[model samples]
Target: MPSGGESMLESDNGTLGWLNFFHKGIGYFAYTMHRISGIVILLYLYLHFFVLSNLLRGGVAFNDLITSFTYGPYDIFIVMDILLSLVIFYHGANGVRLMLNEAGYGLKHHKLMFFILESGAMILMLLFLYYAWQVLLSGGGV
Candidate 1:
């Protein structure tokens, strides 16, 4: 009989490991990205609420927070904002694709659908970044 450690190792070997999960195929990649994007958006929601709660301290506090975002050193926040927007766009678009697949539309062409979804997401992100860059150069906040 195999030892306990040997049995455990066997099971682990048969399972999809972390590196394998990423390298399997486009479906796995899309699934992983969807999960990661969901988690990021959830975390961003908490941060958004925390920032909004500053209003409880009155207009000055809120304005200070807003002002910090508009200045020189805080320009990084604009970049983060754009990244968050891209994540949101990707998650939302992929979600719609998933819904369509669930409804039995394009089930046979899952790989192709994933490619289209990813391409669309990239295009949208690029357009968004372009607009955001224009705004930033014109001295605007995200």
Candidate 2:
């Protein structure tokens, strides 16, 4: 059998090393998702502001830009929007859980709190998506 140092070196080597870092537990999973969602939301905020800036040009320019999102290859944008909404919801819910833990609340029930927060986020995301889908399919044009 390999020595401890040799085993550590082996696990540090390639794809397995990366995969080994995630999903070890609820805390680990939540930490990873929180970081990822935070980054995604930050990037979306930048893009959102940039797009909104187009409105400064004129009503016609703004209308044309918005109109471009309604059909064709831009249909993928709808899926992305839904994903962004879910990420935002997850990030917000997880942030609250983390805040409570830091504040000396729910420390003993950390795992349970993680589960409850994640479930609540999912339920909220589903409800939002249901309404979003209705708006999308009703020819509401986002």
Candidate 3:
């Protein structure tokens, strides 16, 4: 039978193999981030849809639902809300860029493409930070 140390090493080997697969090249980085952003946006959409569904139940129900989501945990909500927006925007914009490329209209200059992608990501991040700051300053508890 394998020793305890041998089994542990085997498990770790498997884990490292998975990590190595993801670290292969720049393509993996883009694919990983794209997937993560998709998940985040999906979660946000669920939350937003749930909130809007309350509207169908009447104004009072919607108000109560909003209050429950935003009050008491104002700081946490603000942070999540800001992040949700950024995730959605980045995922959407990146998806469009990727689609264009797939359709044979991609950027010929690799450096310029990456630069624009990074710039767009940074702009979105800054916008979220700015909103978070606004909330904090206004005593929204963010």
Candidate 4:
């Protein structure tokens, strides 16, 4: 629409440039996910403090929380744990990819590099999912 051969990322109105950034490449998407997953992991760390603080209240309180987590219908937490594994994997793989890029590697083959890193993350996520499901089915559930 620009008639001068600008990419789709450059909107005719110019105000939507941010919206088009995701289409730039896998690297950008991976970058965004990295930031998001880091935030999520940070938030989870805070939640750990909250949960573990129960120990100070009393051992029984802490034990109850642990019991609730490992028993009953709390399967959702395990599912979340599996999802968190995925986020962790993606965050790590993307971090490595970014490091290699900063070290002057994979600049020319960025897309391929992105695919390889993300594929490895997916595989690792699936492996974790399998192990987590086994735990869930083992009646040790958690």
Candidate 5:
């Protein structure tokens, strides 16, 4: 018989755990997005804490940290903001779906409802991007 560690490794040898989970169905897609978005939000929380901690040094230090993202050459900040917004939407929407199912509502049409939720999420994302672009054009940042 295989050792415990060997068996565990063997079980996953042909497939990546969560990536394989993606192929299952809409339910799995919702599950994976929820997990991934939760992780991203958690990491962003850690980053927010670190950024705020800079304020402990002085207002100047904090402003400097903030400037690095808001000023030139770091479109990454806007990109991350967009992505974070999208993740937050997906996570919250999926949570609502879970809550609905738990309450014995929409269990049969959960997939259709998920698509509807995702469409709304996409609209919100586009609205965010439009405003961010306007801000950029207004010389709010370089």
Candidate 6:
């Protein structure tokens, strides 16, 4: 038989080529980005909930924070908000599909669910782009 390196080269030349492996690597990159974005969104949700819970202390502090958020560093906030919206939407929609698949629904409707999830993500992304443009035009006032 051929040596180990030669066997690997044979497989690489056969079906499991380097190009296919590169594409698969890209898929893993997308998956990792999705996971990381989801975690960031979850962290934001926790912070949001914590702030809302502060409504217990009457309106002044919360309202002040809200006002500060509205007018604060417009450029930074606008970019961050747009990015966060995309991340949260993608993460949430993709996460539901993942959960459904994990519960075995995927076995029943794998392609259908994947299409649904992908379409939903695309729609959300477009909506976010539109809204982001609107916000930018509005100078991030609202």
- TM-scores of all models? 0.74, 0.77, 0.61, 0.72, 0.76, 0.53
lDDT of 3: 0.58
Q: Which stretches in model 1 have alpha-carbon errors above 4 Å?
A: 1-20, 140-142
Candidate 2 regions exceeding 4 Å error are 1-20, 140-142
Candidate 6 regions exceeding 4 Å error are 1-23, 73-75, 99-116, 125-142
lDDT of 2: 0.71
lDDT of 1 at 49: 96
* Candidate 4, position 134, lDDT: 77
What is candidate 4's CA lDDT for residue 72? 44
lDDT of 3 by residue, 1-142 (tens): 1111112123233433423425444443444455678877777789789778888999887766666656644446766777676776666666665665556554454335545776787687887788766765675453
Candidate 1 lDDT over residue span 47-131, tens digit each: 9999999999999978777767756557578778878988898888778777777677766776777678778988988898898
Better of 2 and 5 by lDDT: 2
Model 1 gets an lDDT of: 0.69
Evaluate residue 134 in candidate 5 and report its C-alpha lDDT on the 0 to 100 scale.
89
Clash pairs of candidate 2? none
**Candidate 2 TM-score over all chains jointly:** 0.77
Across 57-104, the per-residue lDDT of candidate 2 in tens digits comes to 999988777656755445677778888998999998888887777677
Model 5 score (lDDT): 0.69
Show pairs that collide, candidate 1.
none
Top-TM-score candidate index: 2
User: How well is each residue in 1-142 modelled by candidate 4, as lDDT tens digits?
Assistant: 2111122123443554333435556544555466678899999889889988889989887777776676645646766776778888887887777777767777677678778988998998898788866765795643
Decoy 1 TM-score against native: 0.74
Query: Better model by lDDT, 1 or 2?
Result: 2
